[model samples]
Target: MENEEILKKSQKEISVEGTEDFPLVEVPESERKGFWSISVVLLGFTFFTATMWAGGNLGVSFKFWPDLILLITLGNFLLGAYVAVLGYIAYKTGLSTVLLGRYSFGDWGSKWPDFVLGFTQIGWYAWGTATIAILLTKLLNLPQGWNIPLMIVFGFAFSWTAYVGYRGLEWLSRFSVPLMTILIVWSMTIATKDAGGLAGILGIEPTKNMTIAGAITIIFGTFVSGGTQSTNWTRFSKTAFSAIFGSLIAFFIGNGLMIFAGAYGGLVYQEPDIVNVLVKQGLIFWGIVMLFLNIWTTQDNTIYNFSVAGCNFFRTEKRRYFTVGGAAIGTILAILGMYNWLIPWLVLLGTFIPPIGGVIMADFFYKHKMRYPKITKIKFQKFNWAGILGYVAGALIAKYSPGVPPLNGIIGAFVFYVIFDLLFKLFRINNDHVVEGEE
Candidate 1:
């Protein structure tokens, strides 16, 4: 089919599967999916260029095979556990991250999350697209002049799945994730063989010394923002078990492989991206396939993330406009080299983003005792000053306190929010305008 026809059909309308539009409403039990489906999409979400980017960095500091594995394993396990906790909460609440924020941050205050979450995903979308364009030019021997146009072309091309919304993302993830994983494993096998097998790969010494803490930070920092907002997809989980398994397997195994693939290629070929390493090893066709599928799986979800964020932010029924607008903006950013310039900034933002999760988690599990006010019943506040301040408290600690900034932010937010929330209740400082049970 022509790309234009495909794009047109993509935006035509949402079917039932694509109609999970009530961001604040509980997802009906009948609609939730089981383990495998959620896991596949989660795998797609975690497997992307950025994971490989981190892996490549780790390659320079591999230490030894066991130490490296332990580092990534322990690091991702912490992150995965954090995400799984949120996923389980999502399953219980049937609300997106933004919707959940309404409880903690008040109605107007939730926009902080809505905006930050949405903005980060938009950045990811642009970076993923730009990376694709750069790789394509290198693979095709295209001139530099084509980069901007290619970014535009690729941006629209990948966004169709996202334009169709949830069902589109699920369909694409199931089909593409396995293919991408296979190509990655194939590339790893080639790289290991080329590097004189596992012994040689293991024998390769670290060019720069890295601490365990540093390795752990890289693992978490790679996906903290995405993982924090995982409720966007996790709300579809049929059971807490599914959510847990999906997150754990995706983080511990799926993410492990992507990072390993990157580190392996980086150690062997002096390039962190496995696709580029494959190309260096003269596997151009596989490199191109890997690069395309890798970025495709990631970029669609990035757009989907923005779509959810946009819908939540604007409180709109039609999110396709946001989807298209996000794509256009992301593409424009790619054309202007947003990815290259934003790398360090993106990493820093990752630390700040997780504290938002911490506050919500604390509010849900502790203060509410796992029972949120029904969406229809509650007249949420305009501002929950404590929650907002708690997030700021977390961010400040993360920035200055040092030791694993993301963890510091999360813990700080969780502690401060809980403490302040209790004091508010003790002093009878709760919102006077709210009804107890207004549904």
Candidate 2:
């Protein structure tokens, strides 16, 4: 009992950081998390309502149920593979994406990823806050006039969780992840019953026809950006195996569940959001529970991502300021309905982010021979033109030359960054490598 109390107390100490900087310095092995703990948080992050929304859209978009299931499973596996690479690096190095970018994009050039990652997260924060508010109004049959205040209330409330940092995230996840999973399964069961049982659900047909590639893209696109950012959680993994398996399970199984829920709900009820479907079936209590927990999980993480990005960009310790500021902007945007308007823009922006991953992979794996220099004594470059160009080239390819834009961008950037960096080394053009830190 004494040992158990000590363990609980230790976790409580680490669980709520409460207005401190992200542990940007290298993490000691003792500080890392094992598979189950890290898996819960990572899985929690992907249990997003947006994914349900995407799945619902796919349900109508594809003509066959088997095809939708295949697409979602396959697409998420690809996503899992994409994030697993970074998760391994995070575990190996004990570094966040922002810190890792310092090695590839240079000290100052790395801020571009910080900005994109941070800025996009802020957009999502607002979208989520707005969505929850909107859904609440619908669920409770409240007056529409309450929407703005609701956004502010939820936005600020959720932002506080990010302010406390990953511990708070972990705490919330421990309680919410399991509960939310139960709610999801319960809701799906209820939905299945309402649709005239399993056979009836199986017989539901898609109202529209879309290409397999397009369908897969939507599934992949639902959380691709979040998948890239998952290193934030996976960085705490105790070992590379833990990181890989934890992240893979979250991405493939956790994410796949969300997609299936949305697609199933959308097909049977013609509503993409399962929250609405629940309400339609006179399960308002469950609707409200799922709605709040679902949106809260994603929104807090969105704010936390922005805070880390802000810290990287400004080199400041006042993460709370960024959290508040980002939440405020997100609230305003939600008030202005950026939720709907910003979606396509956000998806387009997601394609550009994977290049950063590609560049980082090349730099760490091949250029540095898979050993990151010690951060406290490292002499990494202030700017790496080759990496920057490769990232730009990848974005251009994604935008213009696309066969599946996101994959195109990632592959294009990976190949280009590798080749270009080699050229730079051969010709000594930019001399992008860091000087010896010890010297």
Alpha-carbon RMSD, candidate 1: 6.0
Per-candidate local distance difference test: 0.79, 0.79
Off by over 4 Å in 2: 1-23, 342-346, 436-439
Tens-place lDDT digits, model 2, residues 320-428: 7888899888888889886675347545655777788888887788777888777767676788776788899888887777456777777888888888888887886
- Lowest lDDT block of 10, candidate 2: 14-23
Q: Model 2, residue 163: displacement in angstroms?
A: 1.4
Assess the local accuracy of residue 394 in candidate 1 as a C-alpha lDDT between 0 and 100. Answer: 93
Cα lDDT for residue 244, candidate 2: 96
lDDT of 1 at 66: 85
lDDT of 1 by residue, 1-439 (tens): 6998988774553233246445546676767888888888888888887788788878877754787778877878888888899999999998888888888788888899989988888888888888888887888889998898889999899888877766777887887788887877787778778889878887887776667666777788777778887787889899899988898888778888888777777777666564467677787876677668767877877887787777777777566778889999899888878766544754576578989998998888877889886776778789887788889999998878867777888999999998888788789887322756543
